[model samples]
Target: MLKIRNLVGGYTNTPIINGVDFEISKGEFFVLLGPNGSGKSTIFKLITGQLPCQKGEISINDKSLSSFSKLEKAKKVAVLSQEVQISFDYTVEEIISLGRFPHQKGLFKTLSVEDKEVIEEVMEITKVKQYRDTQFRMISGGEKQRVLLAKVLAQQPEVLLLDEPTNHLDIKHTFQMLDLLKEWQQTKGLTIFAILHDLNVAALYADRIALLHKGSFLDVGDVDTLRKESQLETVYEVKVNAQSHPTVPKPQLLMTPNHSKTKSELLNFDTSFSITKNDQFIHVQFESPLRTISNGVIGEGIQWLKHFCNFHVEKHYNGSNPKQDLQKWMEKYEIPFEQSVAMMTAVRLEDVVIVTKQIEDIKVIAVVTAGTGNAVDITNSSLSQSHEKVGTINSMVFIDAHFTDGALVNGFMSATEAKVKALHDLNVKDPETNTMATSTSTDALLLAVTQQGKETQYAGSGTVVGKVIGQTVYEATHKAVQKYFHRLQK
Candidate 1:
């Protein structure tokens, strides 16, 4: 429904969207991706009539965008900009109702049933109904964004133009809002043009991505075509690696680290327990050295576990002399004896899922205890049947080990394959069972699995197991616990 060819525009009367070209089909979710100053917002402005398109052709449904007047543009499409300022004291309903202004005839135009229904439906979809009568300024930034979304939805235009719409939003709200838009695009056939700075989100949602570098369209294609190991480095001037989202079958991108962040800039030290009768409770000791940042945040690195799980953190690390920087966090967080912990985080709550399953053929069972906590499993639990009910924790992580939070799959063959790979890489093995272990370091969320029952012994690092305890345990435990603790996040 939207098409741009050799499009060029920018704020300075200078070119920002240099020679960009692409076509988005009807109801497709299109995304514009680039660095902070790459002029993504300018492209949105030029298309929305806020700024003139200095060069190139912009069209909606084969008609030139430049042909539309201000009112005409509003009739054709809705634009939600990145930088918005709201100083009005109007109620949420009033603000969303304002979206209907363009469609109104005069000041006294009577509200139609259609308009009323549209307003109510938009409010409900955007979840601004609770604040429908509340003053717009009183809500949080995220809630206010939703209200604005309601206003845009109220516009009832055929297409959407959003710039960093998910900025400042929490994961839940981001997913909810985007999910609503996705539904609209599917059922209502609304075309979308969104400016996204997050590669992962872009990868997950966009139908096609236009990657921009210093004021230029470096590449344009679907998620797979746009995400590549080498080209991404050239566009962002940062290293990145691509991997498949095991479940979604999409091309997921992870930025590679320069490693120059610091000796402590990107670092993690984690230890797991044997989880034997002698040590039913695992003792985990983590040492994270901190490197100062313009902003205190960690980076996700693949070859390293940091990138996959987003365990990036900002903490104070004393190097000249080994001070207790890491110790203070361990003590401060009060990690339970068998609980998991996540480090360098500002707040903690429940977002953990415990999944258990049964693999009867192996004559073994597995229980995986995982949360958004700071615990990593070492081994042996891969063969045991019963999972643990250990407490929660938060900590800095080393991704070279197994996760307890929802990472295991259902089938034993694949799970065994992953385990064998991890064990081979870690050079660790089960003395009796002789099965290899699987390992990953991403910190997004975690799962910890413990196996109980049966005579299980580790044999070697490369041996493959026909039966899996981790899978069985994951199948058995996840759902009920997921529902009970989902609201822990504040």
Candidate 2:
């Protein structure tokens, strides 16, 4: 546990830290975030007693930090600074063994069996055992960081201070270091205080974040509270967009780029598409890979792809695993599987419906192809159907507008709701459930956009973008569904 209240300090005649107040709960992974020269490293110095506090108090476990002796402080707190320089050619094992000096009688004292065991364990934990005899200067930058970390672990301190520990490391090493720290914090209840530049990294690991600006604490709270786009934009003096991580549900910040775009340049839509029809399939091509979100077989869910195909499969075609079949087809056709999105249906391409609408000067387009073979009313499905429909419905929405990824996700949700509402309006139902059918069992939806013009931040139900998606998808889907039912009657 660490506590700092009304903390003020800096070099004489030039104060760096303003009145700062915060507390780190026991065993909490707390992070400090700010731009360069925000006095983050200065705070570390004040806490470790390298720089004396001009005012206020810092305490560890209710004990004043100033009360601790050099050895006492070393035993309770360990710091890894932003840079570590090794001018001397010291062996990795020898460097790490120095951490045991605080516990021993003196630096020159004979090493004990317990010290050796701790050194071995720390080396193994940090994955530096193989480099034990190598000179610290001979290893890679990431290896040096790991070796230094092993030394700090050898100190057996309860509290660890990391100042941009991931700086200069590659992605792999950065993640490896943080993942190890997280594991240690959870398993050993090690308290950690770190300063990080990457907002996403802090969100992923920190229990709470403290934002510092110009030697003062701007805000301090949980990740979600401190990472508001407006707050971060003001603090960092840049445009910021907050979005959820696709897999983790954590808030991540993306810095908006600043540039000038003329009206003519902004209006130039770089997106173009071509649709080709064969006897058994329809191929859709894009001028470039579009940021697409879909449930199609190949390019399913939030990816960049340039091509898609809607194939006509037989009613009795093996449907046990559509993705597997798609994979086989892609390999046979020599397609770049990762760059393609594909779907299948018993209905022909001629039956697809395309609808276009304009909302608030933005253009929205919807393409829908429907089938009822696999439709089900999700409410009362206990009754077994005498026959199962093997058809599929595939829909695509394209917008001549720009959107943030978060807004795009919201647009997808709104579009789906509109499609189901269209079905309800048509009185479409599943005989088993006696309720309106929302979506078919194997339905696929694709959301794409030209990403031109002004940026739309939110696409919830009340937004203009949402309204356009609702109206266009509803009209298009209604027509497609009606066509499907008419074909069924025939």
Per-residue accuracy of model 1 over 80-138 as CA lDDT, tens digit each = 76554677789989989988866877669666778889899999888789888898778
Candidate 2: where is the Cα deviation over 4 Å? 106-108, 260-271, 288-293, 298-308, 318-321, 331-341, 356-362, 383-388, 402-439, 454-490
TM-score of decoy 1: 0.58
Return the TM-score for candidate 2, rounded to 2 decimals: 0.86
Candidate 2 on 1-490: residue-level lDDT in tens?
7889888999885789988888998789999999888898899888777898888898899998889998898899888876878878999999999888788876577779999999999899788999999989999888888888888989988899998999868888889889989998999889999999899999999999989989998888888965588878777888987777888867887786788655655433324677777656666777767668888876887776878777777766768898888778767766667788888877766788888898677888787888766666767656575334655778888777878788889999989999889888988776667677777777888888767767888886899989999999999989988898888788
lDDT of 2: 0.83
Question: How many clashes does each candidate structure show, in the order listed?
Answer: 66, 1
**RMSD for each model, in Å, please?**
16.0, 3.5
C-alpha displacement of 5 in model 2, angstroms?
Answer: 3.4
Candidate 2 clashing pairs?
A: 373-389
> What stretches of model 1 exceed 4 Å from their correct place?
105-107, 260-490
